[model samples]
Target: MFQNSSFFQNFSTLGKEDTPKSQWIVEDTIANWWRPNFDPPRTLGKEDTPKSQWIVEDTIANWWRPNFDPPRYPYIPAHVTKPKEQTKLFLVQLPDKAYFAVPKNFKLVAAPLFELFDNSNGYGPLIASLPQNLSRFNFLYNPP
Candidate 1:
């Protein structure tokens, strides 16, 4: 519940004949968050760019915005600007070698730490490895 002051009373007049909506409009607004009525500035070619780089318009992904159909949800989020964008790229290079191998003691060291398991039916114990049997290795060896 809101306080019964002038602040809450003004909200009742919003979009009504009593209040003017022009006061809410901001100059040169770009909606990068999520909205249907909003037309944000197009940059970097969203249609041509890879999905991994940016979020593209999709059915389930754009569920809150609702495209050529009625809105499935009743509520929507508010859009806000941060004045600046931040992008960070990480690239790791591996040493030049013929083949990669896991240490003999890796299983013993990783057993007590963590394990991957599938719990589709119910909760179970830790598994040795996943179906794909994938593992990550950090090569930080220095040779003299």
Candidate 2:
């Protein structure tokens, strides 16, 4: 199936350019805040621990703590966080392929199809339950 397909080659090459810079940015940010060298050396006394260590911890704790005020946005709620809602999904299988659909209020969390169906041989009643256009379905996982 492999060919000298420039389309595939070019498509793959498109993402390579930003990969190294993105990796470096992530590495630098992590290194700046949590570098191993910034850690207290085994030989060093308690007082010898880098001030950076405390600063990083304080930053993290402040971020997580509700009362810890974030910089200038005083009026904004400090404890504001998104609440996750339970999701329900349906799995519809055709003779050749499978479809995973989520209801309007729910989100789709992609996972292996084999987890729900017996893929050992083939889709059995699962295929028959699906409509001809592959729309009718049943719940894959029920949320509590």
Candidate 3:
């Protein structure tokens, strides 16, 4: 159906002759985006030092800063960061309310939205047995 189409007529040499018998070859010299060896440096730590900072320093030790002085922003922050305590308070309050309001006969049905574990264990059944409104609250309060 593609009569006189440029795609069919164009016979540009896309591949190189790697072997005499090999017809299919890749001609593009550009590097592919796929990075199997690329491991981004871990940014999470007590000081929040980016992994790249260590990698760059180790790789290019001789490269001096513009004025032969240390950079203004250190590879890691100076402060010792700690996790916030408010998260525990938010988690505990939900179950307490659900315990008093839910009836004994009412069964909690675990939905996919509430299920976090891949093993099909843990909070799946407990969450499934909860009321529909209660199940939805988990989604609503989840951080963006």
Name the best candidate (by TM-score). 2
Write down the worst ten-residue block by lDDT for model 1: 10-19
lDDT of 3 by residue, 1-144 (tens): 011233332211111112222343121211121111122333465466322111111111111122223331212233524211110001112221112222233332334533432422443222223333233343345544
C-alpha TM-scores of all predictions: 0.13, 0.14, 0.12
Model 2: weakest 10-residue lDDT segment is 11-20
Model 1 per-residue lDDT tens digits across residues 34-132:
122222334565775221122222111111222323222222334512212111111223234322222232221222223234531221111222222
Off by over 4 Å in 1: 1-78, 83-89, 97-144
* Cα RMSD for candidates in order: 22.1, 24.2, 28.4
Over 4 Å off in model 2, which ranges? 1-24, 36-38, 42-144
Task: Report how far off residue 54 is in candidate 3 (Å).
Answer: 45
Worst 10 residues of 3 by lDDT: 53-62
Task: Give all candidates' CA lDDT scores.
Answer: 0.23, 0.27, 0.24
Displacement of the residue 95 alpha carbon in candidate 3, Å: 7.3
Q: Roughly what TM-score does model 2 have, to 2 decimal places?
A: 0.14
